[model samples]
Target: MATDDLNKPLGLPRERKAHRTPLVALVAPPLLIAIGLIAFFAFGDGPDDPGNVVAAIDDTSPDQTGSVGPALTPVYEAQSEPLVEVKPTGGLREVRGNDVIISDPSKPRPIRLAAAPFEDLIEADENGLLPRIGDDGTRPLDAYARPAGATEGMKRIAIVVGGIGIEGEAGQSAIASLPGEVTLGIVPYGEDLPATVAEARALGHEILLQLPMEPYNYPDIDPGPNTLTVAGGTAKNLDRLRWLLAQTTTYVGVMNYMGARFTGDDRALAPILGDIADRGLLFLDDGSSARSRVGAFASDSAPVIRADLVLDGDTAPAAIDARIKQLVAIARERGYAVATATAFPSTIARISAFARVAEENGIALVPVSSLVRADGS
Candidate 1:
């Protein structure tokens, strides 16, 4: 009977025991929860999240293995020189020291002729139709450039740079990477379009003026410091355009930079297109607008060539590479492809490297205008 009473007298120890049980129970649930959370995070399906999909498929390409698109084949070449001979100092017609008349035949004696189309005046505008006489007298400057297919053994690639806004270290370096025979595009309103064009020309790259016009955002969009706007009336607009185009001495043609409003206005652009034709220059419409009047107007008015693709619309290195491959494929398929891409460190490097690949694949990079003749067959 006394044993039960003695056990009951340990009241302080009993109370401590009761408090310890609840504390242990309370702590166990939280500790277990923390461990479960760590396990879930460590082995969870995180990669399957929507945020990772872009990273996964960003660089994927159908022809990732470097297979060419179509076999290249020859389309055309010059049979004979197409330039006309002009005599200097020999009479009413003469032949002076390297000087000859490049005047248009359509005009009368010192007359006014509708300056022949860009392709037609090739021999006249740039020093009077002598065809850059080689010592052998066999070179043909007026002859059509030969069009070729991307066969198993052809190696040619056109390198194109679309945007050149201002002269920074990065811009200079990007321009410097272009190889011989590559084509370059410069902004007509850049800090120094003339200097940039001349520099590119000296390096043996063909040049084009990237014209700025109204974009989708219109008044809201600043197309650099100088842009051709509809509100400026046709005459002022034309004058501004002409001045911009003239700023670059090296450009062989002009291409649209971005034009949402102008592209929709056939009536306003018709005369501008006519002027482009009148000036013996080609026009390239960068595919910025689905309702572009430039292409149709060009077909009817001048030697117009529109850009097929903007290669670096998305500037990721891998994306640029895929687009380059796609352009190559398209060029091979149609015997020629014309694309424009902005100048970026990654894009320039990738394009410079791709030029080598193009040569290996027999895809020659040419001016956008060359494709018309290339695909004429």
Candidate 2:
């Protein structure tokens, strides 16, 4: 009786044999379902998905069918507007109301002029037409000098670029490129004196007659024809000066070319300066002569201003730039500074670059005439 009962558990009645599910049977359905889902996502393109959508096209159009269009073609229409007249201001484009101000990098604002050869300012002498004070007490310094605009609180820098008209190309380059506030020192012996001067004046540069005077080495180093000399008496030097003044019209003053010996001698210099004062012209000392007696005569004679620096003494670009920095420092310290330079190509290039940015640095480039002090202060 008990032989069958050995395989069964000892339970109250004969327990029904329990059935166990196989692991594969339990997991196979879900595993198969996940594989199916991944395959569907990877390979199936759903109808409602934008990524699988295809654009419809009308293949019936002439352009798509390779047929030519008609002879009449559509044209684009745009409104045409007239150009406005722009006024030139230094290096900035400014807009005011409906007007536009454009900057001309090449053409600087011109200094105002009173027109050349005021009849009252000229007198016939043995040399030529000499500049003189008008019968109504007007001086050439006032008549021909470029009027200084409102400088106010800014530091003032006056630059005189000399040797213009001496070399044709260099002179033209200087005139064409330099700012209007720069004064030009025209040599007495340059060709086309009147025409060159007129061109420079038209561009707003104040003019100065560069008087050739004897240097320390006198005859060994001549200053060219009609040079004023310490040996030349006041009468003789005055004659030579008149010749120089006669070479050009509309100059505000005279600047010495090479006058170490001539300017150091007060006896020889005073009378010449006195004559310049009598003619109503200013006198500029180029500052080359350390022993110059110009200050001694300035109180009694022509208004005098000495150059604070010679910009192109070295003629290198770096040297010129360094000198310009020094010049600004001087101006900042004294409220005004004057510098003289030859019309060298390097000098003109550096000055042109400097002029474009001078105002922003609080430096006002004024005409040399503006800095001339009668008492030589």
Candidate 3:
């Protein structure tokens, strides 16, 4: 107290030091923290390290074990030409061409077996028409055969060989010449209508009888000797219709040869429509005239519509081509269209061209029944 009393206030011992000594110690911890934060912000993880996030999620470090497994790639081989794969069956096999592939090892592989080649369904003649196979054998004309150059679910064109003066062996030959998908429209004018009907049934083709009806402005045009008319009144007309239907035993439906006059009168045609509906048969209008009430009557009869716009009034190649284009255009606008032409060779060629157009355009060519069935559905 005596020595330090001059410098101190007489209560405590004097200890003098730098002004900032304690302050330095106190602020050192916060200053160090600030420096550490700056360093972290400047040099922490960044995009330069691509593996930072991806590697973290995938965990695909270079040190991982076990193989990742083989990479998948398509397996297709070069071929000289298109190959047709044929599976072995238990019957005699007849491969028509050398390019046909007997078996392929890449797939599950076809089981090899012995079987006979398919016998020709119809015995073909010079022009590709087939004769009735045998006296007892049924004729083999199916309406829904596979189409020419067809894949699964493709539309087909149907044609029948019996309507236009084709009979017996000649008729069979024409039917055979037709592609399998054509519907066989048979007229009863052949030598033996029943026999011809039997043959058509055997061919697996759809059979429909052509009904004779009264046409406008052409009363002399004969559908057949026994035809229905408005002149007969209700009972007689019904009887005549029943008889006409009975003429062909296995026809699934009927189309008018010419009926502009009779169809205009609903009173005369209603009973006939009832008979057709009662039999579960379809009515095809042929769309002869716009005024034809066949469509109007079909609502009650559950009738099918035939949207035929292309008759190819002329069979010239260019004319036929134009009509076909018109047909496709109409088909694209509507869901579908149906047109019929005579059985002349020129007509056949024209239709064949139209079929090609249908293929190119991805249009379907289904049967008349398909059109009818669609309405019911």
Candidate 4:
């Protein structure tokens, strides 16, 4: 110990003093954190303070100067009337609020039938003019139907070439090439539908309104705009149906586009069929779904016609020809048959060729209206 002490510097302390942290350093961090939290709770934007939030302001309020301001009472509470007011356009009926009142059953007379829509057969609505049964006991079904050919004691076949107005060139070709006896079904969603329908009618083809309806694989396989669905209630579906009916005029009947699920449900289908019957229009079941309940609910006044076969299920020419042969056999066995097809080139060609030899083969090619049987025989 004495030797080590001798080696050490004379002015240096033998043991270093114990180190201590400054009091301010230890306390400052926690004090600063507490102060920051207190300041945030007291002065920050809280639930009660909605800073710079914009809301709907009442334009009619004199106090509001169209400047950004705090939200007043809810806009809905300040008003008790409907958002929009609808007035009645001149028609057979007058619109009072949402109700339609017929003016006089004897006063509004039926207009003369023509290629254009009959004025008495139309009722004006918010959407457009919709087809309606005339007050003088005239039905659109009878007015628009192509006169049926003599089918007594002979095999009858009605071929419906649908999907007209969808593809412009193809539709025009179908209208030009096919015989007038083959009914043309017009889709409402197509462009220039009125013109297309007018052209078809001018060419002596009877028209059917091809309405879009919900299929089994809906949403994934949508039928397009204004498609009536099973999930939509009766009121909503009827409104949609009216919108479709207003698309064009001079169609003899309504045929479903694709409606597997909708036709299977009696609750959903009955009201629509009833509405069609009340308006004096026929309903054609395309025979796409075996589970369809159309016949059960159809009215006696306007019977529904179910298709015997679909001619172009397989769009190949040979397949279509074979189906046509089968259709002839069905007509021979049942005395009458109704067949539907798309406006495909192959289908149009096959049908055009078959139509030439149909009378020679003892088959009378008739319009769809000729096949309507009330007894469902």
Candidate 5:
């Protein structure tokens, strides 16, 4: 039913580096240094190389290490005309080409820094094909992510009830019944995806898109229309993926619907995983099959956190309760645990009741994101 962080470099095209007016350009460091040395030694000025004059006014900032060597610095040739002398009127001002500009010192300069935090870096296109995140410095997925909210010594348990939005009423009930900390997975075919997402967000539960990928049964037991398949090849699969992604927004990640066969094939899953990584989203394995390649494929390309347990494989009240207890035990033993289940009414009731009581036992039920890697790496 359900569904994961870690960065596999998404390789999204680099946003233009922010254009900054460097401190040297404004302060004329080279000019000041040259003037000072001359004044101290011979009480006279040195010959002004137009190259040095332009270099002194260079707005190019430092490199990755914040140090620039001459080889790395851009060389602006001396124009046939002599270099123009720029007088500082005060504040932040720099020379570009032959013109000198002045900026108000009191006002803040606008810098659309690509390397800024996630909130600043995320930009939604009009089509919203597949949203992309900026460099590793900005992880919108992690910024919008959830923490366990557990006490210092509490064992954390995170669960996701998948298959929401397929059967409308059933989906609604699952959203209302389950605690907000429990994550919900929505199908792309939902009659009203936006409304469902809005209601789920209102309830404080994080949403994930459930993609229908091919299963072992194939045509005999189809998950849904447009199931991602190896036969579709990488290009077609990505096209299908774009459609699924367009259905909603603010979802933290995506998980497979019935992808046992499709997920196991690396040739089919690798490119898909890369796309997921490229976007600022997580990937949940659902742990539906032992042979699923999501775990290994994720570790190598896009890292994922596979479910530690399937909460309602048997859907019976007693079975679900037992699984909750087992999950709590595992969490207590391992410090954190992850579980996935369908939206069966009985399953929902049993796990909800167990989650309420588990807290009294020092087990903190957390959002599924608690198990995700924060840096999305």
Candidate 6:
């Protein structure tokens, strides 16, 4: 493991979603004409639509893409500002004064991406929600995987911009702002998580579900509701996990959200990681904890990638830019590097700039899936 010396001045932090339309009822005069339609143009085939919305459960699995090539130490974000509401985007957790992250407390609106879900991989439950395991292959993690196209000797770096699907506009901005090679880790709590995922896939970005996990602080510093808790036991935790997994498809794997406590116990987490593997998905440790045991458990079984840096722990333009440079340096030294960051505007903007400049610096900006261990994960 690379020491924190790679970059320490600014870094580590944790994890949002975003979109909706207004509903306007039309009541004309003349015998009280009834013309009330939800003006909120709900896009095609969303979760709320009549048919079960399966993002990408194709019956025929996509052909196997080529393999893993390579590749953090940063702080999770600790924003102290008061929460505020953003119009259209709704309520948000403000950061960097003007920057915002999508916040989800109550049930969210069913977000639908402009693109259609890949149908072959779908298997609908009684509720018409496609969250169960599919027969054969066709898992979204495989069907929608972005090809790495790694060269023989190029220094590769994989970057995961998480906290997606939280704040409406920020999430969209992130999808548009960064290149598709940057893997997006979407939180399942978002009302439009599946939709955000659709947009991500449309743009050729690999996706990962940011599974909520118990931080050591427990209820004090919660990752979010329905988080897989240590007390939840394997049965309960797996049940909640399946629900989360059903929220979206067309991604490569699963990532952690403040899982310091949940990942500490070897026996406690083994079944969870094992299940993720069984689902034909990979596991990514965001590296929030230097002492996390995910590395050990995943080593023998799952296809996993751990973070080398938390890009926005400092949450400032200069600090974030500096972290990018540090990330580039690590990639050059190790042949590959992976870093995780929240969707703060500063982080997104800085990473965007770095992606443009990375190739010029002799570094290849690769997807998170590309960084999985070489054993054909």
Best by TM-score: 2
> lDDT: which is higher, 4 or 5?
4
Worst 10 residues of 4 by lDDT: 59-68
Which residue segments of model 6 deviate by more than 4 Å? 1-122, 126-139, 299-301
Lowest summed lDDT across 10 adjacent residues in model 3 is found at 55-64
TM-score attained by model 5: 0.65
Residue-wise lDDT of candidate 2 within 1-377, one digit each (tens)? Answer: 68757545567566577877699986897899999989867655343433332211112111211121221222222223222223223212343343322333443233435336899999988777889999998888878877667798999999999999887788888887787788999998887888888878866788999999889888899989999998888888888888888887888889999989888898999888888899999999987778888877765346888999899999899999999999999999999999999999999999988988888999998999888742342
Q: What is the per-residue lDDT of model 6 for residues 1-377, given as tens digits with 9 covering 90 to 100? A: 35634433356421212333233322233224322223223343233444221121111111111111110111223343222222222111122333333323332222112234467655566423442235665555555567776456788989898989886777778886677778888988788766677667665578888999898878999888779888998899977887777777666689999989888877678888988876667899997788678888665347777899888889999999888888888988889988999888878788877877777778887788767744566
Model 5's alpha-carbon lDDT is: 0.69
lDDT of 4 by residue, 332-377 (tens): 8988889999999888889988988887889887778766732532
TM-score of each: 0.57, 0.70, 0.55, 0.68, 0.65, 0.66
Which window of 10 residues has the lowest lDDT sum in candidate 1? Answer: 53-62
In model 5, the Cα lDDT at residue 280 comes to 64
lDDT of 3 by residue, 213-264 (tens): 7776655676666566778788887666665665545455677666778877
Residue pair clashes in candidate 5: 6-376, 6-377, 7-376, 7-377
Q: Is candidate 1 or candidate 4 better by TM-score?
A: 4
* Quality of model 2 by C-alpha lDDT: 0.77
The candidate that achieves the highest lDDT relative to the unseen native structure? 2
Ranking by lDDT: 2, 4, 5, 6, 1, 3
What ranking of all candidate models by TM-score puts the best one first? 2, 4, 6, 5, 1, 3
Q: Which runs in model 4 stand beyond 4 Å of their true positions? A: 1-114, 373-377
Q: What is the lDDT of candidate 6?
A: 0.68
lDDT of each: 0.55, 0.77, 0.50, 0.76, 0.69, 0.68
What residue runs in model 5 are displaced by over 4 Å at the alpha carbon?
Answer: 1-129, 135-137, 299-301, 374-376
